[model samples]
Target: MSETSSGKPGLTREQLADLSRHFDEDITFSRHIRAKVKEAVPGEATLYIDVQDFHLNGAGTLHGGVYASLIDNTMGLALISEVGVRTATIDLNVRFLGAVREGRVTCRAEVVHRTRRLATLEARVHDDLENLVALGSGTFRIFEKQGRPLV
Candidate 1:
């Protein structure tokens, strides 16, 4: 799917809200690092993560684990949007390409495959300079619970 000039898909505000909620629940550090669900297509979603010192590593650089988490969350959110339900990560593979410093980062995820019980997604992390910092792929198992869903 593609984006419009506003950096969003052609979805209405309500639709965007619903899609954002699919991935917004697990994000508890909103006050420290702003997270925005920018878009959601049939099998894809984009998550924006603003950089802050709280996300830094011991070396004062952005943590690789943080990048991995962002990728995982974004990809899982994309799968949820596609499947219309909650899911749990079954497997994840991440590759770090560059360093992330003090700036905003964007994690883009696309669902590559979906089955009755599982979904696979690919994601990329880019720094504010538009440099690729990491790439990841993950699979999630769809769950049917009776309470609030995991994002």
Candidate 2:
């Protein structure tokens, strides 16, 4: 992955599409997950996710870990869309807003600030009714790897 003159990822729309496909195929953990890039700009992006039984807790409710993972995934994916590089979460802070039961959930994330080495993003998880179920913020360290990139 490369960056554009605008400091955004250099991937074209087609490349982004291909990247999404590859992400789906390569990231087995996210196999049951679906995401859509709602917005993208230099160092910023937003995505959405849906909640299903596979993501539920033992109580049949949306798991807290799942919410955390959703936000983490959203922030990471947003950073990837902007930086054109793989990133790892160095720190994460999540707050439960409300109980998440069944149905779909939408997660939105955006890069709030960034430097050469690190980027910060904020994400929110909402239930199908559009109620905020959780909120999170995270920092990721950008890096280049020898193998395939996941985000």
Candidate 3:
């Protein structure tokens, strides 16, 4: 296996896509919302979502739910990269610090803590200009899979 910049095993695009596909059923809106998995590596992940009118709130800013969804997926991906399995978010807390009117929003997540049964992760959502729009943390239940194709 190749190594990522962080010295973790470089997950192939196929492996990443497989993990993303597993979550699609749970986060179906990700497709409609134009979310993309930008990067996935052990303990780290980045996701991007393009802001469209449909993603806007009544105030014409990005909806809080969109940020929450992005954070959940990003953090989940980070955990998945580390554990090579699916994870279900159990507790998620988000803080809206600012708002985005247009352009792509990026979410970067890191696995902060992990144990046999659960993982704790943190994420930050930023606008195209790299201004922090939201901050989030979540806990997820890890499920180890048997004979699942990873690549």
lDDT against the true structure, each candidate: 0.74, 0.72, 0.83
TM-score of each: 0.79, 0.79, 0.84
lDDT of candidate 2 over 93-128, digit per residue (tens):
999998776667777888888888798999888887
Which sections of candidate 2 miss by over 4 Å? 1-10, 32-49, 144-151
Top TM-score prediction, candidate number: 3
Question: 1-151 in candidate 1: lDDT tens per residue?
Answer: 2343466433444544666774565557532355777776656788887778888888888888778778877887677655656678999999999987788889999988877888888999898889998999998998765224422
The alpha-carbon lDDT assigned to residue 141 of candidate 2 equals 95
RMSD of each: 5.1, 3.1, 3.2
Residue 51 of model 3 has an lDDT of 90
Model 3 C-alpha lDDT per residue in residues 41-94, reported as the tens digit of each score: 678899998899999999999999999999988998888777776568999999
